[model samples]
Target: MPIYDYRCLECKKRFDVFMTYAEYGNKTVVCKHCNSTKVTRKIGRIRIAKSEESRLENFSDPSSLEGLEDDPVALGKMMRKMSGELGEEMPEEFDEVVNRLEAGQSPDDIEKDMPELGDDLSTGGMGGMGGGLDEDF
Candidate 1:
């Protein structure tokens, strides 16, 4: 199926019509706004789709981090792209971190304000029991 864009010469209104291969040439196109038959078909731009593997590979490339260290907003957007490529549901804290980064906050400042978001705290170092899970359970 292909979508065709048309602009009515009478009302000067533009609209889109989705048509199949069989009906593409046989049917008459009409303007949706004014029901005008004097419409001109337009050439629309084509779209391309990329594979998930290609998107993930782009995310993993080191070049993706270029200039990110100095730009907090770019770093946040990069983190979003990374999460999208991984196809996993990021935690709520991850969104907060990204939001703060986009708001021009440094990672060190964010860590100081929210210590639970620290690297060591992400593991079993902070809230977990004194002993390993295996020893308790």
Candidate 2:
């Protein structure tokens, strides 16, 4: 099945039509809101998928770690992107830590608040964050 996006000319609203390959050109699309036949197919956003090896390589690149220790916002963004690339649900603590980092909270303060964060994780040489996330992870 294919999802076709359309914009109604008369109502100026967008809608989608689901169809099989055989019924695509043979079927007529109607505006879900206005029931108008005057509609035009519109291109939609595109999403790209990468292999797991490639995603891991991107995270392993040393350049990606530049200034992340000093900049909490960038660190938070990196963490969020990593999580998204992994395409899975993260724990509540992960979300809280990322949100705090993005909100300009010092990593040291976050570490003090969340003492359960273990020291087993490695930071890949991006430490010196005032004994915060860098020291443990």
Q: Each candidate's TM vs. the true structure?
A: 0.48, 0.49
Q: lDDT of each structure? A: 0.74, 0.76
Give the clashing residue pairs of candidate 1, or none.
none
Candidate 2 off by > 4 Å: 1-49, 118-137
The per-candidate count of clashes, in order, stands at 0, 0
Instruction: Give me the candidate number with maximum TM-score.
Output: 2
CA displacement after TM-score superposition, residue 65 of candidate 2 (Å)? 0.5
What are the RMSD figures for all models against the true structure?
A: 14.3, 11.9
lDDT of 2 by residue, 1-137 (tens): 88898889998777889999999889988999999999999865344587888767778878888888899999999988987777655554677889999998878888788765544233321222222333433
Q: How many clashes would you count in candidate 2?
A: 0
